[model samples]
Target: MKLYYTPKSHFARKNRILIDALSLEVELVDAGNVADSTPEIFANNPLMKVPTLVDGHQVIYESDHIAAYLVRKFDPTDSYQVLTNDVNQLNLRAVMNGVMTAEVELIMAERSGINTQHLKRFDKLRATVTQGMNWLENQADLFPQQPSYAGFHLICLWDHLLLYQMFQLKHPHLQQHIEKLSGFDCVVKSTPL
Candidate 1:
């Protein structure tokens, strides 16, 4: 199996952590800078997105779908509960994805020479991120005590936020959770370059 990813993408980082945590023997292919059109990613994914997985004749795109596929294929019993059946975990995952989407949009806009602070859509995007963060803070107890799928997503998002300096997250509970898992080998090995 081959997983196409960019080192700095929070989306790709989620899968990388999962692969490492499960000790899956998958080839990691850097898709180059996603900011530009990359033929390699485009060949496997029509959308040209990172976190695309190629297993034999099957091609998978989208980070969440790829994660589900990985868990089902490599860890069918989901011993790690990386892809849980719990509603709270599923909802948390959706919220995290929303925040990630908003961040990516704001980043792309800023890179295109647009002053995001002056645009209404950008304002909405910022609001989405803030709302997501607020929701996560309120449901802090739902966070897993161990490193699971939702926990990995939160860690990846937190790292991305720090990397881009896009938002100042002051939630103590979330901070504590991240700090506790910071030393996990899966996280340590997958730290973005």
Candidate 2:
């Protein structure tokens, strides 16, 4: 299996954390800036996205979907369920996904030199991320104590926000959660890329 990913991609980082936790070995290809698609990667995923995986003849894209595939194909002990099986956590994961999507959309717009300086859509995206953070803070008790799938998603979002200085996340509980998650071995190994 070969996985195309950029070093700094938060979504790709989530998969890396899971892959390490499961002790899976697969080729990691550094596909630079996903938007600037290379011919090989573009051939594999027409959408030209990173975290695209080629397993046998199967092509996979999207971080969460690729994560599920990795767990099913490589993790014989079904350890992936530790990350995917909780319904309540899944709801938070959905919210994180939405926030990440909106944040990336705004980022893409900015990168494209679009007029996002005062755009309502850009502000809305920022607000959405804030709301998600607030929700995560309120549901701190619902979060699993261990590093689950939703935990990984939350950490990835938090890490992205920290790395890019995107937003001011003032949720104490969520902030504490991220600090705790950051100390995990899987997360440590996946850092500095």
Candidate 3:
């Protein structure tokens, strides 16, 4: 089995954390990205993204899909995955997805050094991310009692916060939410950041 990914990518971090926690051993290979329009990227996935996996004639793309597939295959005995039979875990996945996108958008925007024409949109995105973070912090109880899919999602978001951290300064507010999530040991171990 071969896991093709770049260590520097956030999505790749998700896959890597899962790999670490599940203790799945696979041959590591760096497929880089589709920037130069690599043939393997197009051949494997039209998206030309990192973190693609080659497993037994199966080609997997996207970090979330790859993580789930690897867990299902390598850690089948573990029923406490993020997307499992549990309804709460599924709901957590949904919540996390929203937060994850907000984080990604904010990070990408910040990295560009300017919001430019998208000022209103950037402000809106920042507000939405803050709102989501506030809400999650307020309702920490909604997370499952056990480490599961939602747990992974929260941890993944935390990882993104540290990695991208679009907040330049005066962003101590998000830290409260992050601190709340960090209370979990699983979050510490699973988070790549």
Candidate 4:
């Protein structure tokens, strides 16, 4: 199995952490700048997205799907429950993904030399991130104290936010939740520098 990822992508970070947590023997391939659409990434994923997984003849794109496939295949016992059946955690995970998408869009736009503040679409994106984060903050107590898949997703999102300085909202509960789980080896190893 081979996992193609970008170093700075939070989505890739989630799967990287999962790979270590599950102790899977998969090759990690750094797919240079995603924006450049390297042939290595494009060949595996038509969309040229990060966190693309290749297992034998099967190719999987999208971080969530790759995580699910890995958990289902490598972990027959489902010990980590990476694909959680819990509805609340599933919903929280979706919201975290949304926030991540919105923030990534904003960062990409800024990097493209676009004045995001002047665009209505960018405004909506900012609102999506802020509102989603606020919701997550309110539901912080619902998150597991241990390093589950949903917890890892939330940690990745929070770390990305900090990495980009995207928002300044107060999320003390979420912060504490993340801090509690930060000592885990998988998380420490996969954290972006």
Ranking by lDDT: 1, 4, 2, 3
Model 4 whole-model lDDT (C-alpha atoms): 0.87
User: Which candidate achieves the best lDDT against the true structure?
Assistant: 1
**Per-residue lDDT of model 3, residues 34-139, tens digit only:** 2546757433677776778888899998777887788777776765563466665465555556766666666655666765345887677777667676666656
Residue-wise C-alpha lDDT for candidate 2, range 1-193, written one tens digit per residue: 8888878788888898888888778789888766785658533677777788888889888898988888777775656453355677688878888888888887888788897766788888888888988888899877767677777778888888777777887888887778888888988877744
Instruction: State model 3's lDDT.
Output: 0.63
lDDT of 4 by residue, 1-193 (tens): 9988878899989998889999988888888877775566544687878888889999989998999999888888766667778899888988999999999999998998999986899999999999999999999888987678888888899988988897995899998988887989989987888
All candidates: TM-score: 0.95, 0.90, 0.70, 0.95
lDDT per model vs. reference: 0.88, 0.79, 0.63, 0.87
Error of 3 at 6 (Å): 2.8
C-alpha positional error of residue 180 in candidate 1 after TM-score superposition, expressed in Å: 1.5
What is the TM-score of candidate 3?
Answer: 0.70
Clashing pairs in 1: none
For candidate 4, what is the total of clashing residue pairs? Answer: 0
Question: What is the Cα-based lDDT of residue 56 in candidate 4?
Answer: 92
At residue 16, candidate 1 shows an lDDT of 91
lDDT of model 2 at position 3: 81
Error of 3 at 68 (Å): 2.6
Residue 177 of model 1: what lDDT? Answer: 89
| Candidate 4 structure, TM-score to reference | 0.95
Predicted candidate 1 versus true structure: per-residue lDDT over 106-162, tens digit per residue = 999889898998588999999999999999999989998977888889999999998
